[model samples]
Structures are given as structure tokens and as C-alpha cells.
Target chain A: MSLSENLFYFLSFLAIFSALMVVFAKNPIHSVLYLILVFFALTGHYILLNAQFLAIVNIIVYAGAIMVLFLFVIMFLNLKKEGDISAKSVFVKVAGVVSGGLLLLVMIASLKSLEPYQLKADIKTDIGLVENLGKVLYNDFLLPFELASILFLAAMVGAVMLGKRESGERNF
Target chain B: MVEIITKIPLEYYIILASVLFCIGVIGVLIRRNALIIFMCVELMLNAVNMLFIAFSAYRGDASGQVFVFFIMAVAAAEVAVGLAIIVMIYRNTRSVDVGELNKLRY
Candidate 1:
């Protein structure tokens, strides 16, 4: 195996392991930490795939912003109480695992039937760089790009509306 | 650098992404904490993003990458609104457990 393949294997293992930890960790804070690690490994995968712009954006948006939001909510809620009825019944847990495993199997099976195609020589070279990505984003995808801004604005307004304390309530 | 990625078949990426997505699904189904389920949803999104980048690189098209960019944008917005809703629920019930907040059901 070459260096790149070894790196891919290592990164995939880290990502999968941390992703599992994100689900299974007892403390919500630990789950957030694991999710950050998963994002980091994903960033490495993006870099390996030559999507430099995406790698940086993934790190900034996911690890930096989203994970921080999760951590803040977790800490603010003070969810450290013990003996809460957090555990699901065994039947439910087993059903979840079985169904999820079946989904994975079906997806992989479908993928195996696809015809193999040769990698295009000139295609994978540097199209993922910020310069080329920007050109395409501005030209072909300009409309969607502008619409995303509007989505952000609406989300911000909705969040503020939902989170604000009522005028007459002082339950804290 | 292209040789490195090309040496590994695209199917590997497909399988990896599928596994990650399945883990996310399982996490969502079993976890009671709304915050943890939210994190699982993010995991599923990342899995899809990885597949997009991989396919884009394989086909030598920037459109896939652009799609990934939009997915990230939508995910960010979703997180903001969803977290705010979670915070509101917690304030009213003093718990982040989804099972505790089923008052809306008929």
C-alpha cells in the first residue's frame, strides 16, 4: 500500500470511531468532543481529496461554530444529573442497531453493481482550489449562492424569536 | 497527488460514507438526549458531504463541490434554529430528553 492509501485508512478509522463515540458517550460534553474529532478527520479527508477550500470551510463551520454551539447548550443546561431515565429499552436499542446495519448493507450492495470507470486524467487536478471553486460559484451557481444568504438571515431571525424570554415571566 | 486518490477506488468512499450514515441513524434512534440526536444528524450530513466531495473529485466536476457548499450552508442554518428550539424546550421542562417533551401528541 502507498502512503496515501495508508493515510486514507487511518483517517477513515478515526472518523468512524469518533462518530460512534459521539453517539455512545454518557456525558453530552464528551459526545460533543467526539463530534469535533470526527469533523477534524473529515477535514483531513477533504484535504486528501484535493478540496482545499472545503477542508478549511468544514473545519471552520463544523468544528469551530457548530460544535461550539453544541458545547454551549450542553453546559448551559447543566445536564449532569445522575439516574435520569435516559436509557432506552433493550428491544428498542436492538431494533435500532439491526435496522441501521441493514441500511448500510443495502447501500453497499447497490454500489457494487455500478460499472467501473477510468479516472479522468485532467479532471481531478486543482478544480477544488478556491480560485476555480469561486469562478464556478460566481458564474454557474450565483443564484443559489445569493439564496443561501437569505436562508441565513431567516434562520437568525427565527432563532432570536424562539430563544427570547417572555416579558412577564421570571421563572428562573 | 491525483495518483494517490485515484489508486483507491471510488467504491471505498461509498462504503465508508454508508457506514457513517448508518451510525448516525442508529444514534438518532437510540439516543434520548435531543442534543445527542442533533449531533448524530450532523454526522449524517458530514457523511453525505464526504461522498459529494469524493464523487466530484472522481468526475472532475466542480458542481459536486458547490453542492457540498450549499449543504454546509443549510446545515449551519438548521443548527442555529434547532439549537434555539432545544434551548426553549429545556427552559420549559428543565431536561434535554426528548421522551420527556411529548406533550404535543394527541
Candidate 2:
């Protein structure tokens, strides 16, 4: 196998494994850490896809900033204990498994109908570069682009409002 | 050999991404921990992002990738607000179990 293939396989495996760990890890902090691993693996995949800019931004926004915020909240909350996980009824487990199995089956069946097509690596050198993305974001997607900041503003206000304590509440 | 795998059809990516998406759905269903469930949601989003990139590359257009950018933005906003809500729930109920938060089910 070529180096690129080997790299792809290795990175994909890492991504899947870390994603599983995010769900399996008991500690919230550990779960977040696993999520960081998943993001890093995704960045690797982005690089392989010739999206160098997306790769870096994925790291910066997800692994760097967002995870740090997650870590802060997790730590602030001090939710380290493995509290009672939940009352896991047999029916719930069965339902989860059956639904998941059905979804997978449907996806596989649909995918079987697609004709195979090869990708040429003839990527534009400008692909995923900051300048190119910026140009598109400003030109073609200008309106939605401007509106995103408003979305963030609304989210920030909502979060702060949610964090505020109720007048009668005793804790937190 | 390198070229061959690099040129593997878009179908492979679609199948792989679909599998990941299904698994994420399962995780969301099975896991009761609020944090784990959130991670599952992230997993599902990433799976979709994979599909988007695959299609973008296949179509020879960057627009799909641009949509991926929007998805990322929405995801970031979601994570920020979602985690805050989770924190608030935890603070109030001292619990993060989905089954416990039944006030809205009515």
C-alpha cells in the first residue's frame, strides 16, 4: 500500500476509536479529551482531502477554542464522579440496538446503488486557502455570512441568561 | 497502489460515512449520560461533514465545502448553547440523565 493509503487508514481508525471512546469514557473530562482526539483525526482527514485551511480551522475552532470552553465548564461544574449512570431498562437497550441496526442496513442498501467514480487529485492550489474561502464567504454568501455574527450574538446572550441563578435557587 | 486508494470511488466514502452516522445514532439512543449524548450528536455532524466533503470533491465545486463551513458555524453555536443548557440542568437537578428531564415531555 502507498503511504497515503496507509495514512488514511490509520487516521480513519484513530477517528473511529476516539469517537467510541467519547461515548464510553465515564468521566466527562475524559469524554471531552476523546472528542479532541476525534477532532484532530478529522483535521488529518481534511488535510488528506486537500483542505489545508479547513484542517487548521477545524483544529482552531473545535479542538482549541470550543474544547477549552467545554473543559472550563466541566471543571467549573466539578462533575467528576461516576454518578448513577441511569436506570437501563432492557427495552431501551433493545430499542437502541434495533434502530441502529435498521439504519445501518438502510444506508448500506442505498449505497449499493451508487455507481463508482474516481477522484482526480487535480485540486486548485487555492482550495481551502484562507483568501479563497474569505472571498467566497464575502462575495457569494455575503448575506448569510453577515447573519452568522448575529447568531453568535444571540447564542452568547442566551448562554449568559441561562447561566444566571434564579432568585430563589440555593445552589449554583 | 497509492494512486488506487486515493482514487477509490465516492461510494466508499458514502458507505463509511453512513456507517458512522448510524453508529452515532445508536450512541445517542443507548447512552443516558447527557455529555455522551452530546458527543454522539457531534459524531453525527462529523459524519455528515464527511459526506459533504466527498460530494464537494466529486462535483469539482467548493460550494459543498462552503456549506460545510455553515455546518461548522451552526455546530459551534449549538455546542456553546447546548453545553450551557446542560450545565444549567445539572445545576438545578444535580443530574444530567435524559430520562430525568421529563418536564417537557408533557
Candidate 3:
């Protein structure tokens, strides 16, 4: 009925469609491209929710950097040859459907039973802005913030070591 | 157009995020490609980030936004390292099929 609603619906549809393609696409490159689409749609959703900083960062980091790496690696691997088994067995298909259906039912039932609470009209639109987020990051979440950086450093070293191909491996 | 956004309830965002999360789970289950599985993982993370942002916006608290920041950082690091590992696996085995990499089975 409204522009925001229309935008939400449009982005949501794109997100779901691209997500489906991420799974269904036969080529890994295409899968990465669809993932990029999903990330962009999510960035739009973030912007609509008043997280302008997140939207920009999401595009810069996800759609820009991470997806490029995904594409690069996919290309480097030369994995153009489709897998031998592209189709799933009927049993796995049934199990996947059943599990997803069950989870959906549970979520809907819980949400329905929980009464909605009225929120205060006071909004903090600047909460997600870079400056405000940075303040909170240092003030309230300082420990976790520092720890996360350490984790990233460790992950970086680990990845470099892992990706370095070993010289020899004799199969017994 | 700007006036219409104020009327939107936080529940709508939560519901949408839940749907996205579910789709991610389905993708993880039904697909075998390592890269796609990685994408599904990212989808799940994004869905959770949406929920956090929605709740933060509704409560007028900045904590949720901080968590989203942390989630983004972790996700970026994860994708970087995970993709590198996946590339290594592909090079070693020459296959990215999930079912084919079941060597850890007991």
C-alpha cells in the first residue's frame, strides 16, 4: 500500500529469489553472483531499517570484497566441471522438506502465541550511524570488540597456512 | 513516502528475517556444493543481523547495532578464511562435493 512496504516486498522477493539461485545454480561462479545479489538486497533492507552505515559497509565488504574473493577462488579452482551427482536422492529431499516444514511451523506457532508488545514512539535514528556505533563499540562492547580483532588475526594466519599447498603426499 | 516508514512495525522485519533464515537452512540442506553451503551460511548470518537490527530499532537501544557490527566482522573474517580452506580442499581432492568429502566419518 505504501512506498516503504513496496520496497520491502521487492527487496524481500529479490533476496529469496537470489538465495534460491545460490543453492540451485549449477556453476559455483553463478552461485557466488547470486550470493552477491542476496547481499545487495540485504543492504537495501538495512537501509530501509535506518542502518545507513551498515548498508554502505555491507556493500563495500560483502558485495565488494568478500564476493570478489569468492569469485576469485571459484575461478582459481577451475571447478567449471559440474559434480558427478547433481541431483539429490528422494529420501534426502523428503527429509529436507520435512525438516524445513517442521521448523517453519514451530516458528510460526511460537510467534503467534507471543503477544506483541507496544513499543515506545521515541526512535534513535542515529543509533546505527558510524559515530554512534563506534561510541558504543568502545564504551559498552570494548572487550568483545578487541577479542574479535584478535580472532580475525588468527583466522588470517590460519587461512594463509591452510591454503599453502603441501609439497608431497604419498597415498598408502 | 517518508511518512509511511514510521508506520511499519518491527514485527514485519522480524518475520522477513525468519523467512530468510529458513530459506538459508533449506539451501544448506538441499545443496552439496561447498561454495553454496558457504553462501547459505552467510544468508543465515544476514538473517540474524536483520533480526538484531530490527529489535535494536524497536527498543531504541544501540547494543543490538553493536552486535550487528560484531557479526559483520566475524562474517567477513569467516568468509575469507573459509573460502581459502575450501580452495585448499578443492586443490587436494579436486572435488568440492560435500558428500565426497566424508572422510572424517567414524
* RMSD in Å for all candidates: 1.3, 2.4, 2.2
Give me the displacement of residue B68 in model 1, in angstroms. Answer: 0.8
Candidates sorted by TM-score, descending order?
1, 3, 2
Model 1 reaches what TM-score against the true structure? 0.97
Cα lDDT of candidate 3 equals: 0.81
In the range B29-101, model 2's lDDT, one tens digit per residue, is 8888887788789889988987887676565667777888888898899988999899988888887788898
Q: Per-residue lDDT of A1-172 in model 2, one digit per residue for the tens?
A: 6676777778778887887778667788998998899889878777777666677878888888878988887788776676646756889878997999899898899777766664556745345666777787788998987789999999899889888888888684
C-alpha RMSD over true interface residues, each candidate: 1.3, 2.6, 2.5
Q: DockQ winner among the candidates? A: 1
lDDT per residue as tens, model 1, A1-172: 9888998999999999999999889988899999999999999899989999999999999999998999998888888773454678999999999999999989988976899867866665688999999999999999999999999999999999999999875445
Model 3: per-residue Cα lDDT over B27-63, one tens digit each: 8898888887888898899889888987876777889
State how far residue B75 of model 1 sits from its true place (Å).
Answer: 0.8
* Pairs of colliding residues, candidate 2: none
Provide the lDDT at A48 for model 2: 71
* lDDT at residue A85 of model 1 (Cα atoms): 42
What are the lDDT figures for the candidates, one per model? 0.91, 0.78, 0.81
